[model samples]
Every structure is written in C-alpha cells, then in structure tokens.
Target: MTDTSTSSVPESTADATAAEPEATTAEETADGGTERPAADNKDLFRESEIAADYVEGLLDILDYDGDIDELTQGGRPVVEVVGARLQSLVGQRGATLEALQELTRLAVFRQTGTPSRLLLDVGGYRASRRKELAAVAKNAAEKVKQYGEAIKLDPMSAFERKCVHDVINALSGVESESEGVEPSRRIVVRPAS
Candidate 1:
C-alpha cells in the first residue's frame, strides 16, 4: 500500500471547486457583505480516502494484493483496483462490485454527512467492459445509419451509457442519449441529422 495521504491526492478541475462558497448557508461578513463558508470539497477527497482504506482492508482480509489508483471524474472521486485474477471482486455482471460501491459511498456519506458518487473499478473490469460497450455502440450506430431509425439498447448502468455515448459521439453519423433512471436506464442510438 502507498503511504500517500489524502493531501497528496490529485484533484481534477471538476473536483476542486475551491473558489466557490459553501452552499450550506448564507451569512454576513464583517464588512456587511453576504457570503458563505468555503465549500468543503474536502469531503470528496475524504470519500476517496475512506473508500481506499475500506477496499484496502477488504483486500488484506481476503489475502488479495492489488494496486489502487485514486482519481476524479466529472466531479466525483474514483478508486481503481488493479491486480491479477481479481475478477471475483467484480462479481457476476458486476452486481457485487456495484453493491460494494454503494457501501463505500455510504461509508463516505456517513463520515462527511454528504452523499458521494465514487466509482470503484476492480481488476480492469471497467476497461474491458468499455471495449465491449463501444463495440455494441458502434454496431447500433451502424444499424441506425442503415435503417434511418433509432435503435434502443438494453438497459444499462450509467457507466455503460457513458461508454456508448463516447463511442457514438466519436462517430460521424450517430447520436445517443440516456433515457431512464438507474438500474433500468439505457441509451438510444439514432442517425445524425
């Protein structure tokens, strides 16, 4: 395990809203100017730290070894666990991993009194899944282009939708959108106008 502290964790532009005022409450300053406390972006970094510690404990308990990388995406911190033969951490259809992600988020929320959107990727499962989703997206784009009709895909997690969106957006003749809520939300590929 790396001895890096939370202070050393890298922050993306989206993660560090340091210049923004706290959204909790409005107050007057000594000069009679209305302002709020500095927003505690620390909570997000805390979330990643707490999540890392949790996953580390899990790995230790399971006698599994992995290198964890902490990062930020779209304003949320993420933890990626990389190791060999760690597919079980991903679970069947990623159900177990999703559940664990929620648990890790909850752990962060409990400590910071703020909800978190942390993403946890185990054993490069997400990278492989991204490739697969990209292929599905490309295929759907082809069908849409050929048929001149929209193609609705199976319900997918937000991650899958993002992968498809990226793929479709990169193509010359297709577009896509997420059309539902979590657990059943999916994407629709359509011919570009």
Candidate 2:
C-alpha cells in the first residue's frame, strides 16, 4: 500500500556520498578516471528504487496490503515488505519469496541493464530465518567440538548454507564446507585440525 524510495540523497550524507563514488557509479571513478565497474558494487539506491517499484506492482496485482521500504545494507540493495496477512507471499520456507526476489532483480536488470543482487524480504522472513540459521550453525559447531568429528548437515538453500557457513566460520575449533550440487548442496562442520 505504500512505496518508499531511497533514491534521494539527504543533504546530511552528501559529503560522504561525494567521497564515495563507487557507491553510485557503475564504472567511472570519482575523479572521472577510467575503471571497470565493480561487479558486486553498483548504484545501491537506484537498485533499491527499481526493485521497490517492481514489488509495489506485484502487491497491487495480488491485492495485498503492505508497506514497502527499500534501502541498501552491507552494500547490497534490500527491499522489505511489512504488513499483516502477507504469509502467502512468504510461502513454505520462503520459496515464493525467493522466486519473487529473483523476478524483482530481473526487473531491475531490465531497467539498469545490469544484473542485481537485490534482496527481498516479506514479513521479516529473512531476519527470522537468519536467527534460526545462526542457532543451527552454533549448535552444529558445538556438536563438532564435542564429538571431535566431522558432521554433515541436511541439504539447504544457498542462502541458508551461507548463513550457516558464516556462523560456523566465526567459531573456534570448527570449520565448514559445502558439497553436492544445487538443491542438494549442504554444509559440513568439522573440528579444526
């Protein structure tokens, strides 16, 4: 029901923005010199704007009521939809939400002619899932430490595996690795040698 744009640069952040052209430009340097665009670093706000518009249209089509907020986090564009009765958009284990995120990224790519790594969250699914995954990672790490043996976890989505890997990497006496192919990819936590 509401759309928020991150396109406008607040006057307060103007100085920081001027000092960091990489945050906006595709390739060109701050001094207008030549440089290949940072493939992982593009115009974050613009990406958010494009993704927000796309999600807003989707909401309208589904007759859904939600407040959409778009912004950049950790150098990646993020779109969050907040509203009651939005569980269906999240689907089972966020399958639908993941599909919708890819579609939104495609929409951004079509407009900007660049691939987008935009992340979409419906009803705080990702945030909650991250917490849950963190717990899972910690528990697995504990098991590996206690048993002093390698432990293979169930297959997980890329996002889930990434979350687990991040958490496991931070723990001592444990390391993690991914094996298998798509849809069957999983993480293995083992005691450090």
Candidate 3:
C-alpha cells in the first residue's frame, strides 16, 4: 500500500475553496468542446474534498486501512480508495460500492446544497468493471449484428448499463436501449434499422 501521508488528501474544505484561483470565461477547444468554467471546476474539487473527508471518517470508524485520493474527473467529483482487503467495501457485483457512492454524493449535496455527480470507487472496481462491461457490450453487439435480432443483456445497474450503452453506441450496425425497473433493468442491443 502506498503511504497515505504522501497522498493529495485535502486539508480542509474551506482551505480547498479558499485556494481556488480566479477563473476566466469558458473557452472552446480546437475540437469545439467547451471547457468548464474554472469556478465550476473549483466547486467540483470542493465536492471531492468533502466526500474524501466523509469516506476517511467512515474508514476510521470501520478500522479499515486504505489510501484515499480525491479529484475531479469527467466534470464530476471522484474519490478513489485503494489498499488491501477493501473488497467488502466494493461488495458483490458492486452493490455496496453503489450504495456508498450514493451516500457520498448525499454528503456532498448536504454540504454544497447542490446535487453532485460524485463517483466513489474502491479498489479500482469501477475501472475493471468498465472493461468487463465493454466486452459484454461488444459481444452483444456482435451477436445482434450477426443474428439480425435483438439481444437482451442480463439485468445491470445504472452505471453498468451506461457503460454498455456507451460501447454499443460507438459501434456501427447496432444500437442499445435499457428496459425494466431498478435492480432488474437491462440493456437490449439490436441491429440498427
């Protein structure tokens, strides 16, 4: 495990907010994608700090040893916990991880008074799961294209479905959609008309 002392843990939320530099107006990139306003980035960073503190407290209460890192990713606050024996926090099929993420987002919202798209990851579960889901999406897309019929994937969480949809949407000859309700919602890949 890496030394937690050297991690970029935020000292305090106030310090984090106070240290933000003045931001200019959003600028368009060469690719036509607009950069987020610096103040918005600062707010996202603050959300991450608040979430990191909440996770640190939870880890302390649980007597768990892990190194937590907080950062902004894809325009949202992300907190990642890395260390040994952290699988319980991830739980089976990432159910516990999802619940923890929601709680962390709630913590950020309670402090910031705004909804947060905070993503909490434990033991790199999300990164690995994304790879797996991408493969599943590819396989489903291939089957749909080959058979010229819709292929229904097993029920998946919102995050998992999004991963699958992203992969499927990028490929040609096939499209994907979600169906059903929570805990049972699934994706269907079909040949594009």
Top candidate, metric TM-score: 3
lDDT of 3 at 188: 67
TM-score of 3: 0.79
Tell me the TM-score of model 1.
0.70
lDDT of 1 at 179: 52
Predicted candidate 2 versus true structure: per-residue lDDT over 1-193, tens digit per residue: 0111111111111111112222121132211223334444348888998999999999999999999999887667889999999999987777688778778978999999976767789999989988987887787777777778787676555566667777876788988776555444456777786
Residue pairs clashing in model 1 are none
TM-score of 2: 0.78
lDDT of 1 by residue, 27-146 (tens): 212111233333355655677888998889889989999998877654567889998878888876665676677788778778878667677889878788788877787778777888
- Sliding window of 10 residues with minimal summed lDDT for model 3: 11-20
- lDDT winner between 2 and 3, please give it: 3
Worst 10 residues of 1 by lDDT: 9-18
For all the candidates, what are their Cα RMSDs to the real structure? 14.4, 14.6, 13.9
For model 1, what is the alpha-carbon lDDT of residue 76? 67
Q: What's the best-to-worst order under lDDT?
A: 3, 2, 1
Provide the TM-score for each candidate, comma-separated. Answer: 0.70, 0.78, 0.79
**Model 3 deviation from native, Cα RMSD in Å:** 13.9
